[model samples]
Structures are given as structure tokens and as C-alpha cells.
Target: MMARDPIRLWLNAHLGLVYVFLYVPILVLIALSFNKSGLPTAWTGFSTEWYGKLVANPKILSAAGNSLIVAVASTIISTVIGTLLAMGLEEGRSNPWLDALVAAPMIIPDIVLAIALLSFYTLLNMSLGLHSIVLSHAVFNIAFVCMVVRTRLKNFDRSIVEASIDLGASELTTFRRVTLPVIAPGVVAAALLSFTLSIDEFIIAYFTAGAGQGSTTFPMQIYAMIRFGVTPEINAIATIVIGFSFFLVLLSQRLNREAAP
Candidate 1:
């Protein structure tokens, strides 16, 4: 057995502390969501009253509906475009500039992108609403989806494509029969990832949501609630959102692992 180094022990201790610091608030929020009193500091008993309240809130429900529309639309657009981009980059000659351009959405600051998109929409006189949010969310979602699919593609065997061609299979036939099956898991992972990101996105949505209650998304609604005060209902909503995001991320990770060796 390797000896435990003192430096390694110290590093691990610091890392543990960092993780605790990061997740302690989330743990507290989740725990508070079960409080019967709906107060953060006081927990009379365990209850799901706040969750029920969240369900009954029309504004929250409306926002959730808008969020679902945007997430679904963005996921569909991002997954298709991103998968094609990944395939093109993987099969065709690499262009450094093109790669950089594709990656810019992922690398750029959210506020910067949000403002830029808002400005562009304004200049184009585009009506800002759920559609605008969908378009904006797709910009980054596409990059994320492409990156995920590209990871799966990296481990792909090019010889399979060559073998298909050698067998006189058309490109479309080979892609449908072989390439698609190989990449299906990656596609699912990418779609889940895109959906999660679109659901959680706020800055761009806020900027492009325009002056209507019709386009308000769940994240924007949550932000509005947060500005007022933290309530047990907010905690419950947050817990649900966190759980949903966690589930999607776990699903994506599992699919990605399956797509790997």
C-alpha cells in the first residue's frame, strides 16, 4: 500500500471544507423546505404544505409552463444543430477558427451574451417573448450539446464508417444503421443536458423576456420571489428545481458513460 502523505491529507481536508462550504447552503435550503411553519429558522414539523402551495400558485404555474415551452423548443433546436455540427467537425477537416467560433457561446460571460442578444433583438425590432428566450437559450445549449456529442464521437471507430462504405452502403444508410446507433446515447445525453441548461438559464431569458407576464419563466419568477424574501414555498420550489437538474445531469452522465468504452 502507498503511504499517506501529509501534504495529500492537508489538500483533501481543504477540498472537503470547500465542498461543504459550497453545498451547506443547498442542504439547509432543502431541509427548510420541509418546515411546517414555512420559516427558515423555525421548523415546527415536517410537512409538504409549501409544495402544495407552490402547485396552487397561478403565477408560478404560468412561469413553469413558459419555461417548459422554452426548454423543449431550445432542446430540439440545439440537439439537432449541435449533433450535426459535432458530426461535421469529427468527419470533416478541422478549422481552428470555426472551432473557436462554435465554442465562444460556452466561453462567453452570460451577462455579456445576454446583453448582446438583447441588443441584437432590439436592433432587429424582434418581439421579445418566449420565442426570443428559446432562441437565446439555444445559442449556449448548442455549444454544450456539441461538446458532449463530440466527446462520444472522439472514441468512435472511423474504421466502421470505412467498412460500411466498403460494403457499398450509402452514406445515409451507413449513418442510419451504424453511426446513429453508436451516437444515440450521446444524443440523448446532449438533449437532457440542453433541456436542463435551458430550464436553469436566467440572464438571457430575463433580458429577452420583454414586458409581458406571458413570457415569464420559472427562473425569472424565482428571482422575483427572492428579491422579496426567502419563504418556505421558495425553498420547496428551489428543492424541486435542484432535484430536476440533478436528475437530468445524472441521466446525462450515465448515458455518456454508456457511450464510452
Candidate 2:
């Protein structure tokens, strides 16, 4: 029998502790969401009244709808532009500076990006609303989508595209029939990731959303609620957002794995 390595065991133990530190709070939040009492400090019993209240709140519903609209719009725009950008970069000679430029959005602080976006909107004399938020989110999400698509493209068979082109097919035709099919899984995965990011995004949305309740997103709504004080309702909203984001991540991984050779 082989003996276990002490170093490997130690690393595994440390990793487990790290995960517990990260996720234990999330688990506690989820539990508190179901608590009968409104306060996190006092857990009277398990009840879903908080979630019920969330459903009954009209403002919550409106905010959620705005979030959905922004997420869908931004995801669509980002995925489309990012996919094309990834393909263009993959086909060309790589430049380190260009790569850095492409990755800037994902690397920059969210607040920095938020302030930059707000300034750009002001320069353009654009009115702040859900549409502005959608554009801002698309800008933020483009880098993530491009990175994911570029990773998928690393394993792509380029000869297939060349062969299609040689067979008297136009670039558009070849893209639709050959390149698109090969990268569809990656594009879908990127879109799901983009949607999740847009849904949870608060800083940029808060800045670009301007002065209106009509453009308020779910995260902004949660922030407004928090200023009044944390309650079980906020916990419920957080729990749902976390669960949805987790599901999207899992699904993205599933698609990526299935695309693997």
C-alpha cells in the first residue's frame, strides 16, 4: 500500500479550511433567509415569510424586472461583440499590449470603471436610465466573454474554417456554417457568465442608473434596503442571487466540459 504524502494532506486540509471560511457565511445567510424573525441576530424559527414578502413587494418586482432587462440586453451585446473580438484576435498575430487592452475591464476596479462610465455618459450628454446601465454592463462584461471565448478558441480546429473558405464559401457563410457551430458552446457559456455578472453588478449599475426608481436594479434595490438596515428579506434576495449565479457557473462548466475533446 502506498503511504499518503504529508505535504499533500496538509495542502488539502488548508484548502478545506479556506473553502469553509468563504462559504460558511453564505450558508449562514441562506439559513437566515428562512428564519421566521426579521433580524439575523435572532432566529425565532424557520419560515419563508421573508421570501413571501419579497414576492408581494412591488418595488422589488420592478427592480428585478429592470435587472433582468439589463442583464439580457448586456449579455447579448457583450457576447456578440466579445465573440467577434476573440475570433479576430485569435486569427491575427498576437500583441501583448492588445491583449492587455482587451483584459482591462476585467482587471480594473469596478468603482473605477463605474466612474469612467459615468463620465463618458456625461460627456455624451446621455440620460441615465436602464439603457445606460445596460451599455455600462456590456462594457464591463465584454472582457470576460472575450476571455472565455478565446480559451475555447485555443482548442479550435482552424483548418475546418480554411477548408470551408476554399470550397467557395463566403466569410459570412463559413462563419455561420463552420466557425459558429464549433464555438457555439463557448459563446453560450460566455453569455451565461455575462448574464450572471450583470445580474450581481451593483457599482456600475448604481452609478449609471441615474436618479430614478424606474432604472433601479436588483443589487441597487438590495443596497437601498440595507441602508434602512439588514433584514431577512435582504438575506432572501442574496440567497436567491447566489443560487442563480452558482447555477449559471455550473451550467457554463458543463457546456465547456461537453465541448472538450
Candidate 3:
């Protein structure tokens, strides 16, 4: 048997504590979602009635639909724009200021970005709705996607691109056949990350959404519900949302690992 390393053991213990700290509350929440008692400290029994209520709630259904629309639309737009932007920047000389500008949205606080977006929209007299939320989400999503793709590009082999071009293939065709395949994993990861963030986003959506029930995203709806205090139904909704975000992030991590050299 090999000798045990004290440092490794210590690190493992620390990591275990960190995971417990982060996920114990979420695990408790999940358990409580099905609690028949619907009490925080006591668990009478397990029941899925709250989940059924979630399905029957019209307001929640509408808000979920709105979130899906914003997430899908923003993911598509951000993935395309961000991928192209990352490619452009990678092909050009490095500029620190330009890099910072590209990443500013992700670095800045969400509330600040939300307020700025709201101001910009009001100044332009743009009608606020799901579309507005989509646009605002796309702003941060683009930055995140760009950052992820850029990491993939950092280790990219330029020779493949040059070879494809030298074979009389047009730039677009080369990108479709060669460049895109190499970066496909990163693109997928970025898209998933964007979708997850957009779906869970509250502040930006709250600020940019129109003044009506029609524009309420799921997170916004959850916030409104929270004002009335937590219930089994709210717990169920939170569990579902947290589960979805966790899944997407896990998938993104997997993709990123696959893309690693």
C-alpha cells in the first residue's frame, strides 16, 4: 500500500465540508417540497401534492412559458453572436481593453446591468415585454458565451483552419466543416450555460419586463410568491428550478471537460 498524504487528506476533508455547506440546504429544500406536513422543522410524510398544484397553477404555467421563451431566444442569439465575436477576437491581435469590454457584462453586478438596460430601453421608448427580457438576457449571455468559447479557442490549432482555407474552401465552409466541429463542445456548453442563466435570472427580467402579468418570468413569479411566505407549492417550484439549473451546469461542465486538450 502507498503511504497516505496528509495534504491530500486535508484537502479532501475541506472539499467535503464545502460541498456539504453548499448543498445541504438545497437537499433539505427538496425533501421539504414533498413533506405532507408542509412545515419547515417537521416532516409528517412524503406527498407530491405540491407538484400537482404547481401544474394546476395558471400563473406559474404562464410565467414558466415566458421564461422558456426568453431562455431559448437569448441562448440562440447569444450563442451565434458570441461565437462569431470570439472567433473574430481570436483571429485578431490581443487587446486587453477590448477583452475587458467584451467581458464587462459578466463582471458587472446584475442589478447595475438591469438598471442600465431599463434606462436604455426607456430612452429608446422600446416596449418592454418578453422580447425585452430576451434582449437584456442576451447581453450577459453573449458575454458568458464569448468567454467560454474564447477559452476553447486559446488551445485551438490554427493550422487546421489555414489548411482548410488553402484547400480552396471558402471561409464560411471552412468554419462549418472544420472550425465549428473543433469548437462544437464549447459552443454547446456556452449555449447551455446561457439558457440556464436566462431561465433563473430575476433582476434583469424584473426591470426589463413590461408592466403586466404577461411579461412575468418564472423567477419574477417566484419572487412575488415568496412575498406571501413559503408554501409546499413554492418549495416544489424552487426544487424544479434548482434541479434544472443544476442539470444544465453539470452538462456544461461535462462538455467543457470533453473539449479540454
Candidate 4:
């Protein structure tokens, strides 16, 4: 066999190190979550006790419910608005300024966006609760949904829409029947992504949520718990969240790829 290139060997080693750096901590955390003794330093044996405890915890359950409420509401609102915005943007001539404006939320620091939303709510004197959080999340997620849908739209044929209209279908009917069917995969992908983002978001929810347990989301609960120390309970909760978010992101990625021309 020919000798392996030194550069290729070095590059492969570098890639392996990068993967280890990124995933080894996550692997450790997952393992410790199943530790029967619930000690990071020592693993007594494998057990599902930590996850069972999470189910019995009322606070965690309530926060999880609130997160679900916010995620579902925000995803629906954002998907509708963002999909429409994507259609408008994609169908129109591209403008650098307009594109920048649409992408601002995605590019801006999360802390900055959270602060801005809090300030805007204060300015409007809006009541802070799950509703406010839903709106704020929708605002943040809309741009992301639009971006994804626009990618799908990039390969779409507008002639089909025109043909449908010419065939005596009203614009609303055409959109509902013709255009909507073609882009359903992308819409679903965007909605899944929006839901995932809303579920894991913390800074914005913290800033916008009311000062009560009623509005507390899962991420906020996690933050509250982690302030004291890292517990097996926290690890279990994090593992569940991570698994859910990963599933959604992967599903979205798959749908997006399939929607491509």
C-alpha cells in the first residue's frame, strides 16, 4: 500500500478532536443522568430514576406545559406570517436593505433582541404573560421561517400559480389549492424549526414572561434550577429537551432537503 499523506492524517486527527470536543461533554452528561447514585464523580449503576422523578415534579410539568403552549402558538403564528412574507419577498425584486431588515432578528444578539422586546412591551404597556411571550417568540421566529420558506420558493415555478389563476381559480383558491400543496413540506419544516426554537429559548422568555410561576417556561425552570447546582434531575430534563430539539431540527433539515428542486 502507498504511504498515507501526512497532511491528510493531520486533517483527520484535527476533525476527530473537533468532534470529541463538541460531543464528549454531552455524552458524559447523558451517562451521568442515568447514574443510580446521581453523582457525577461515581456511577453506581444505570437507572431511569432521574427521568421518573421529573414526571412526578409538578413545577417541571407546569413549566413544560407553558413551553408547549408558547411553542405551539408561536409556531402557528410565525409559520403563517413568515410563509406569506417569504412569498412576497421571493416573488419581488431583491433589495439589500429589505433583505437586511428581514434578517435583523436572526443576525442580532439574542440578548439585544430580548432587551428590545422587553422595552417595546414596556413602551406599549402590554401585560407580561404567556401571551406576550408567544408574541415575542413569534416575532423572533418569523424571520427564520421566512428564510427557510424562501429557500423552498427559490426553486418554485410561478407559472403554475399563474396557470391556476387563469384556469378560473380565484387567487385565494389558487393559493389554498395549488401553491400551498407544493410548498407544504417547507412550511412544515419551518414550523418544526420555529417550534424547536421557541421551546429552547430562554433570554427572551425570561425578559418577557410575567413575574410568576404561571408564565415560567421549561428553559426558565432549567435556569432557575441550575443556579444552585447541576443535579441529575436537571440532567434528565436537559437530556429530554436536547433529544426533542434534535429530533425537530433533524426533521426540519430532512424536509428542507427533500423540498429542494
Candidate 5:
């Protein structure tokens, strides 16, 4: 083999360090999930007891169901609206101000957005619950989805759209048959991203979920558990969540790669 260049060797070394920094903690946490001792510091052999306990816990089940509701609702709504918005904006005039406005939610602080949503809902006299959480999640989720779809749209061939229109296709038919097919991968990726964010979000969900056990989400439950102190059960829950998020992100990347021209 050719001798590695010093610069290339250095870059590889740096990349290795970065990966270790990012993933070592996550690996430790996953490993600890199998620990029978329930303590973070000591590894007292492997066990699946915590996973069983998680199933038996009614509160965790309820919270997980609530999170699923919010994530799915937000993902569906955000994917539709964001995909349409991205296509419209891309096909229309390219205005920086308008683009910034669409992206504001992604740039804004989560706490600020949560407070604003809470105040807006309170002003409208809307009841805060799972539905409220879904709406709140959709707000940011829409922006995230729009951003991803817009990136994919940047690489789209406008000629295809023109060809469809030239073929006497209606705007709806063109979008349904031509535009959507080209962008479907991006749309799916964005939807997965939205779902992941909705499930993992804590501060915004906490603010909008209102005051009921019925509205408690998985992240909210995790927060409460952490306040009590870490345990093997918490590790199991965290490992599951992290694994799920990682899987969705990886899938999104794969879809995006496949969509690339």
C-alpha cells in the first residue's frame, strides 16, 4: 500500500476522535441498559429485567401512547403542508425574506416558541392536551420538513415540470404525477425527521401538553424519571429512543442518497 500522506492521516485521526466523542457516551448508555445492578458506575452482569419492567409500567405505556399520537399527527400534517409549501416556493418567485420567514421556526429558540404557542393557545381559550401538543410540534416540524424538502427541490429538474404542463396536465395532476414522484423520497425523509423531533421534544411538549396525566409524553416521562435519578429502566427507555431516532436519521440519509440525481 502507498504510504498515507501526513494530512490524510491527521484528518483520519481527527475524524476518529470526533466519532469517539460523539458516540462513546451513547455506547456506554446502551451497555448500561443491560446492567443488572441498575447503577451507572458499576456493571453487575447483563439482564433484560428492565425491559420487562418497562412493559409493566402503566405510566410509561400511557406516556408512550401520547407521544405516538403527537408524533404521528404532527408528522402527517407537517409533511403535507411543508412539502406543498416547498414546491410552491420553489416554483414561484425566489424571495429571501419569504424564505427566512418560512425558516424562522427552525432558527427560533424552542423555549421561546413554546412560550409563544402556550400564550397563543391561552388567548384563543383552547384546551391544552394531546391535540395542543400535536399543534405545537407541527409548528417546528413544518419548518424542518420544509427545509429538507427545499434542499431536495434545489436539485430537481424544472424541465420535467414544464414537460408535464406542456402535456396538458392540470396543476394538480402535474403535482401528483410529476412533482411528487420526483420528491417522494425527500418528503418521506422530512416526515421521518418530523416524527423523530416530535417524539424527542420535551420543553415545547411540556408547555403545551397542559395539566393532565392524559397529556404526558414520553420525553416528559423521561424528564420526570431523570429528576428522581437514573436507573437501569431509564437507560432501557433512553436506549430505545436513541436507537429509534438514529434509525430514522440513517434511513432519511439513505433515501436522500437514492433520490440524488
Candidate 6:
């Protein structure tokens, strides 16, 4: 039997510690979701009471519905615009200003953007509701979607597109039948990632959601619950949100990997 190297053993130990440090709290939260006592300190026994309560909570249900609406709307807008932007930018020679402008949303402080957007809406007298939230979410979602699609496009074979054009296909036809199919996986990945981000976003949504429960999203509800205090139901909801985000991100990663080769 081969002996393990000391350096490798040490590195493995450190990596394990890092992983525990990052995920221990999440694991605890998930475990607590099944607690019968509804207290973090005492687990009493495992039960699905919290999950049942989560489903029965009208406020939570309403907020979740609103979040779904915002996520779907933002994902659709972001995917379409972001994919087109990536294709347009990639087709042309690199322009530093354009690149910076495209990336600005991802880098800018969320709070700052949120406030600026809120102020702009107020100035224009635009009503604050689902539409405003969708628009606000789309700004960052577009940046993320564009970045993901652009990464896929960077490895794209442009020769195929040129060949299609050379073979008497119009540019639109070539893009539709040839280029799009190749990038479909990347598009799906980007849309999923954008939807996840939009669903979980709070700071921007809080600022832009304006005055009412009508536009309250799931994250906003979570924030309110956290502020009041932690409860078993909150734990269950958190577990669900975390699980959904993880699933979407994993799917995105898988799609991107599949698109690669």
C-alpha cells in the first residue's frame, strides 16, 4: 500500500475545515427545519410540522407567488437581451468602453443602483410594483446572463457560421438554424442562473418594491421574519430556498459543462 504524503494530508485537512466552515451553518439550518420543538436549541424530535406550516402560511404563499412572477419576467427579458448582446459584442472587434459599460451593472453597488433606480422611477412618476421590481432585477440579471453566454461564445466555432452564410443562407437563417442550436445550452444555463439570482435578490427588491405587500417577494418575507426572530417555519422556508438555489446553480453548471464539448 502507498503511504499518503504529509503535504497532501495537511492540504486535505485544511480543505475539509474550509468546507465545514462554509456549510456547517447551512447544514444546521436544514436539520433544524425538521425540529418538532420549533426552537434552535432543542431538537426534541424530527417532524414535518414546520414544512406544513410553511405551506399553510398565506403571506408566505403570496410572497412566493410574487417572486415567481418577478423571476420569470426578469429571466425572459434578461435571457433575450443578454444573449443578443453577447452575440453582437463577440461578432465585433473588442471595444473597451462597450465592455466596461456592459459589465457596470455587475460591479456597481446593489444598494446604489437600487436607490438610483428608485429615484428615477419617482422622478418619472412610474408606479412601483411588480413591473418596477422586474426591471430592477433585470439590470443585474442581464449582466450575469451576458457573461455566461459570452463565455460559451468565446469557445464557439465561427467557421460554421461563415460556412452557412457562404452556402447561401441569410444571416438571420444562419443564426437561427446554426448558431442558436450550438448555444442553446448556454442560453438555458444563463436563464436558470438569472432566475435564481432574481428570486433571491433582496436589497434591490426592497428598495424598488415600494409601499405594499402586493409586491412583496419571498426574500423580502424572509428578511422580515428574520428581523422579527427565527422560527421553525422560517427554517423550513430557508431550507427550501437554499435547496432551490443549489439545484438551479448545479443545473447551470451542468449545462455549461455539456455546452463545452
Candidate 3 local lDDT, 43-159, one digit each (tens): 899899989989999999999999999999999999999999999999899999999999999999999999999999999999999999999999989999999999999999999
TM-score of each: 0.95, 0.96, 0.95, 0.96, 0.94, 0.96
Write candidate 4's Cα lDDT for 122-238 as tens digits: 999999999999999999999999999999998999899999988999999999999999999999999999999999999999999989999999999999999988888888988
- Per residue, candidate 1 scores C-alpha lDDT tens digits across 1-261 of 246687789899999999999999999999999999957768899999999998899999999999999999999999999999999998888889999999999999999999999999989999989999999999979999999999999999989999999999999999999999999999999999999999999998999899778999999999999997899989999999999999999999999999996
Tens-place lDDT per residue, model 6, 1-261, is 146687789899999999999999999999998999967658899899889888899999999999999999999999999999999999899999999999999999999999999999999999999999999999889999999999999999999999999999999999999999999999999999999999999999999998789999999999988987888888899999999999999999999999886
| TM match of model 2 to true structure | 0.96
104, model 2: CA deviation in Å?
A: 0.5
RMSD of each: 1.5, 1.5, 1.9, 1.6, 2.0, 1.9
Model 6 TM-score, 2 decimals: 0.96
Query: Which stretches in model 6 have alpha-carbon errors above 4 Å?
Result: 1-4
lDDT of each: 0.94, 0.93, 0.94, 0.94, 0.92, 0.94
Judged by whole-model lDDT over C-alpha atoms, candidate 6 comes out at: 0.94
Give the winner by lDDT: 3 or 5.
Answer: 3
Which lDDT value does model 6 have at 96? 90
Which residue pairs come into collision in candidate 6? none
Clashing pairs in 5: none
Model 3 is weakest, by summed lDDT over 10 consecutive residues, at 1-10
Q: Write model 5 residue lDDT over 19-110, tens digit each, in one string.
A: 99999999999999999896865998989999999999999999999999999999999999999899889889899999999999999999
Name the 10 consecutive residues with the lowest summed lDDT in model 2. 1-10
Q: Model 6, residue 135: displacement in angstroms?
A: 0.3
